[model samples]
Target: MADQGVRTDRLGLLLEQFDQAREMAQVRLTGLGDEEYLWEPVADCWSLRRRGEAVTPRAYGPGEWVLDKGAPDIPASEYAEVARQAAGGMPVSKIAEDWSVSVERVGEVLAFTGTPEPDRTPVTTIAWRLAHLHSCFAGQWEWTFGERRRDPRLLVDFTPRAGLALEAFWATIDRWREDVASVTDEQLDTVGFSQYPYGSDPDDPFIAVVAGSGLEFIHHMAEIALLRDLWRARFPGRG
Candidate 1:
C-alpha cells in the first residue's frame, strides 16, 4: 500500500458487492439448458441462438432492425433512431449479428448503458445475458488494468456458450482482483485512472470507475435473474 491515499477498505467493499451480484447471476443461470438458454417467448423475441440463424435478420419481424443493425450493409440511420427512442444503445440482436456467430450459440445483456436504447428491447435469452456480463467484465478489466483497451464494437462478435460464459465472468473478476490489490489506494483518488474507451473515465476518478463497475454487475445480475424468473413462468414445465 505504498501509494495509499484513499482507502483500500473501499475497494474491498466494492469487490464484495461485485462478488455478491455475480453469485446471484450464477444461481439464476443454474440448470438452464439449451432450450431455456435460447427460448423466445415472443415471435422475433431476441435471444441467443445457434450462431447464424438463431440470431439473424431472417428471424426478426418487419420494421425490427436486423439483429446486426450495426452491420455495414445495414444503414446506421435505421438503428440509430431506434436507439434514440429506446433510451439505450443499438439493439442486442444487431450486436449478435456482428459477432458472426454462425456456428454456435450466443447470448448477451442489452447495452442499456450510455447508448440509446431500441424502441423495444427484445426479450434476451439467458445465454446472451451471461455473455454480456462476462464480456463486459473482461472488457472493463482489460481497460482498467490490462492495458488492452478493448474496443466495444468488437464485443458483438465475442459470444460464448453457456457454462463457459459463466466461467469467463468469474475468471475475469478473479483476474481483476489479483491485479487491483496492488493498485495503490492513492491511484483511486487520481483522476482518469481508468482510461477506458467505452466510458467517461478520462474525466473521472478511478474510484468512480471501480464503483460503477460493481454497480454494473449488480444491475445486470438482477436483470438476468428477473429474466430467468419470467422465462420459467412463461414456460412452466421447463421452469
Candidate 2:
C-alpha cells in the first residue's frame, strides 16, 4: 500500500497531480478559437481535419504534425530517467511535482512551436490533443471505476467540434480526479487496483499505477506541445 511507512497526510499527492494536470491544460487552451485549433501550417499536414475526410492520404496521425507513425519521436526525458535511476526512485510527492512541471511545459510549447512537417505523420491540432485527452481519460475512468470496460477508439467520438471536445476533456479529467482523490490505502497497495487493460495495472501495485500515470500524462501532453511548435513555425506569425 502507498500508505506503508509514509505519512498519512501526503498520501493523497497523486490526487493533487490529477488536479494540476487538468488545470494546466485548461489554462493553456483558453485563448484559442476554432481557427487556431484547426489551422494546419502546411499542405498535407496531419492536423484535425473534419471526420469522414478521406484517409487516402493516411499521412496524418490517426489524428499528426508529421506523416510518420512516430515523427519527432518523443525524445527521452533525461530528468525522469535520472530520477528513476536514483536509488529507490523518486518519492511520490516529488513525482507529483515533476508532473506539474511537465504539464506546464506542455502549455509553454503550445505557445511556441513554430515549424511545419508536411512530409511526416503531419501535425496534431489542438482539437486532436484535446480529444485524445478526453478519450484516454474517459476510457481509463470507465475501466477502473465504471461499469463495462470498452475500447476508447470504439466508444469516443473524436469527431466533435473543438469547443465540445474541450468541454468533454475537462469534464472527463474532473471525473478521474474525483476517483483519484477517493482512493484508499488498500486500493493503493492492491494489485490491479485500476484494472486498466492496456498496461500492467492488472498486476502492478496501485502506487506504481499512480506513478505510471504521471509519466504517461506528461509525455503525451509534451508531444502535443511540440506538435504545436511545429504547426506554428510552419504557418509564420499566426503562431
Candidate 3:
C-alpha cells in the first residue's frame, strides 16, 4: 500500500510538470503567424522544408513537407539518381552529366556515410521546433499506447504552413495526455512501460520516462519561446 501511494504521488508530480509546461507553451504560442513561424534568423538553419527544396541528404515526413536533417546513408536527389544510373550499368561520367555534378562528386555522394554531427547542429525555426515536439509526443504515445510498431519518422505530418502545424501539434498533445492520464501506479513503476524506441524509455521506469518527457517539453518550449522573441526583435512590428 505504501509503495502504491509513492507511485501515485510520483505520477501526479510528473503529470503536473507536463501540465505546467504545456500551459506555458500555449501562452507563448498564441497569435503566432506563419511568417514568424518560418522565419530563419541565419543562413543554413535547419528547418521544415517543402519537398525538393531541402538541402539535407534526405528529408522525412509525409506530404509536400519534411524535416531537413541529413541521412548520409540514404541517397538524396542527385545521389539517388547516380546510384540508380550506376545500377542500370550507366557510366559514372554519364551519370555525372545527368546530375550536373563532376564524376568525382557523384562518387563521393555514393560513398558518403556520415550523418551531421551534434557539434554542427544548426539553429532551427519555430516550425521545425514545434514539429519536433509534435513528433516526440506523437511517437511516444504511439509506441506506448498505440500499435508500438510504427516508425517514428512516419508518425508525424510536417507542414510548411504554420496554422496547420499548430493545430496538429496541439491535437497530438491532447491524444498523448489522454492516454498518459490513464496510466496506473503499477505501470508507472514498470520498466519498459513506455517502449518508445527512439530513447532509453524501455530500460527506465515509466515514472522516469514521464519526468524526462516533461523536461523535453519544457526545454523545447522554452527554445520556441526564445525564437519567437528573437523573431519579433529582428523585425519590429512584423508578424
TM-score of each: 0.62, 0.60, 0.75
What tens-digit string does per-residue lDDT give for candidate 3 at 1-239? 56555344667777777887889899899989988998899999889988899878767787788888764332353355456657778777765655445778778877866552334467988988898888889889988999999988788879777888888999999888778889988998898988887655776788888888888888889999999889888888986
How many pairs in model 1 have backbone atoms within 3 A of each other, for residues 3 or more apart or on separate chains, i.e. clashes?
A: 16
lDDT of 2 at 141: 80
Which stretches of model 2 miss by more than 4 angstroms?
1-10, 42-122, 223-239
Model 1 Cα lDDT, one tens digit per residue, 1-239: 53864344887777767666767666776876656655665666555444355545443212211122222232322444334423445344444354343212223222323543444455565555555655566666777776665564343333334555456666777787677666888998888777666544654688887887777777767766787788778778873
lDDT of 1: 0.57
Ranking by TM-score: 3, 1, 2
Q: How far out, in Å, is residue 148 in model 3?
A: 1.1
Weakest ten-residue segment in model 1 by summed lDDT: 60-69
- Point out the worst 10-residue segment of candidate 3 by lDDT: 71-80
lDDT of 2 by residue, 156-219 (tens): 5554355766676667777777777678878878887777664446656777777676667766
Q: Residue 193's C-alpha lDDT in candidate 3?
A: 89
Candidate 3 regions with alpha-carbon error over 4 angstroms: 1-8, 71-118
**Would you list the C-alpha lDDT of every candidate in the order shown?**
0.57, 0.56, 0.80
